[model samples]
Target: MADQIDDVDFALAAYRTDGEWVVAELTHDHLEDVDVLSAALRRFPGDTGTLGLVAIDEDFFVIVRVAGTSTRLLLSDVTAADEWELAASVLDFLRLPDPEDDDEPEPAGEVGLLADLGVPAATMAELIDDEDLYPDELLSEVARRIGFGELFDDVVGLTSA
Candidate 1:
């Protein structure tokens, strides 16, 4: 799985501390698997919880949220499990079946995970349903909706300037 880590475009952890949002880069060491990524998210201190956003191979994105002993996950494309180990791991973690070859791209897991934070599940669904947006762009929209667009862009080197 070490070789798979190189395919990650970016991994970041965002959370609130002292009523302010903090966005920071997450190491690539655990980027290829869901278990270690959840463990890494648990290490961050946050009033609500930690949000883990990872874009892989420019193909799909995964969102993992950790609060105390509770963890939630969302995979941008279920079909990605066919090609990505990380996406497959996420399906395993979520106790979901592996997507079939003929299955259309659809989001899997807790799409409403960010509801309390701001973005609704419906909006998340809409974003995932858009075929034109890449995984990074989808994640960027998520970060923007949750109030950390600029900070997220800065951390992921997506800043225009």
Candidate 2:
């Protein structure tokens, strides 16, 4: 399981520009760095509004949005912070501590990461409320709500939410 943890299957990024959504590829090895991710998003060739999506070992996921110097994050599983380097880095970014065995996945520093963008964190919390859905499915629902569901599914080859 530890060896498999290093092989992540999805690392995609996109940003809205002039009412258009643009995508760019991100390497799996660099998922732990906000600066690298932010830099990549900033170079997306348009306005600075950028959002990132990444999954690890199909066990957990991350959503990051960057605007100016402020970066926001949402992690699918907070317990992952204790095991995965990527999750640990995310918690570090938000100044959160690793959780105990019974801990639930919740927003650490802020709950409304996407509230300003129209998708409320409360709504997102309700979406992932079901533990049965994988990170991709939860993210799929997120894309659907934000009007990029088809594009996201097409790019990621996932059809169901």
Candidate 3:
């Protein structure tokens, strides 16, 4: 069987508009396939459009954003995805091969992809430096920096709320 996403542990779609946050209408099954996930992202409506947040088996998080024909990503721990179907499918979509035995979970793609949107890359590095934070916790920091801390926390159930 093809790699799937419903096997994913936690997934959510959210967008910010005119200073307010809104959770998009997410149909989980339709996005079970990577191609479909990409398609839905591109279809998301707005200027700073929709954002996809997923945490797989508490091992790592995948953030996906699309602008026109270009899609950007932030995969936490490329190695963690190796053992999970959802993470593997995302890695496949990004055209990355599985990691070797000596690999460590590191950020793949442009870490500054959301800098202009307000989540800075340097700040992310500091958070990951601890090496003990889970995918959701790291994402909480992202949401916090981007002005949606409370909202994202409520949706994702972050403890800092």
Highest lDDT: give the candidate number. 1
Q: Write the per-residue lDDT of candidate 1 for residues 1-161, one digit (tens) a residue.
A: 57687788998999999999999898888675888998998888899899999898988899999999898999998999988888999999999999997998888999998998888999999988888988878888888888888898888878522
Residue 98 local lDDT, model 2: 77
Candidate 3, residue 111: lDDT: 78
| Candidates' C-alpha lDDT | 0.88, 0.74, 0.70
- The CA root-mean-square deviation of candidate 1, after full C-alpha superposition on the true structure, stands at 1.5
User: RMSD to the native, candidate 3?
Assistant: 2.6
How close to the true structure is residue 15 of candidate 2, measured as C-alpha lDDT? 78
lDDT of each residue in 65-123, candidate 3, tens digit only: 76677677777777866676556667787888888889976777667867897878887
Q: After superposition, how far is residue 47 of candidate 3 from its true place, in Å?
A: 2.6
Q: Which residue pairs in candidate 3 have backbone atoms (N, alpha carbon, C) closer than 3 angstroms, thus clashing? A: none
Q: Which stretches of model 2 miss by more than 4 angstroms?
A: 1-6, 46-48
Question: What's the residue-level lDDT of 71 in candidate 1?
Answer: 83
C-alpha lDDT of residue 143 in model 2: 79
Give the candidate order by descending lDDT.
Answer: 1, 2, 3
Better of 2 and 3 by TM-score: 2
Query: What TM-score goes with each of the models?
Result: 0.95, 0.86, 0.82
Would you list the rank order by TM-score, best first?
1, 2, 3
List of clashing residue pairs for candidate 2 = none
Name the regions of candidate 1 deviating beyond 4 angstroms.
none
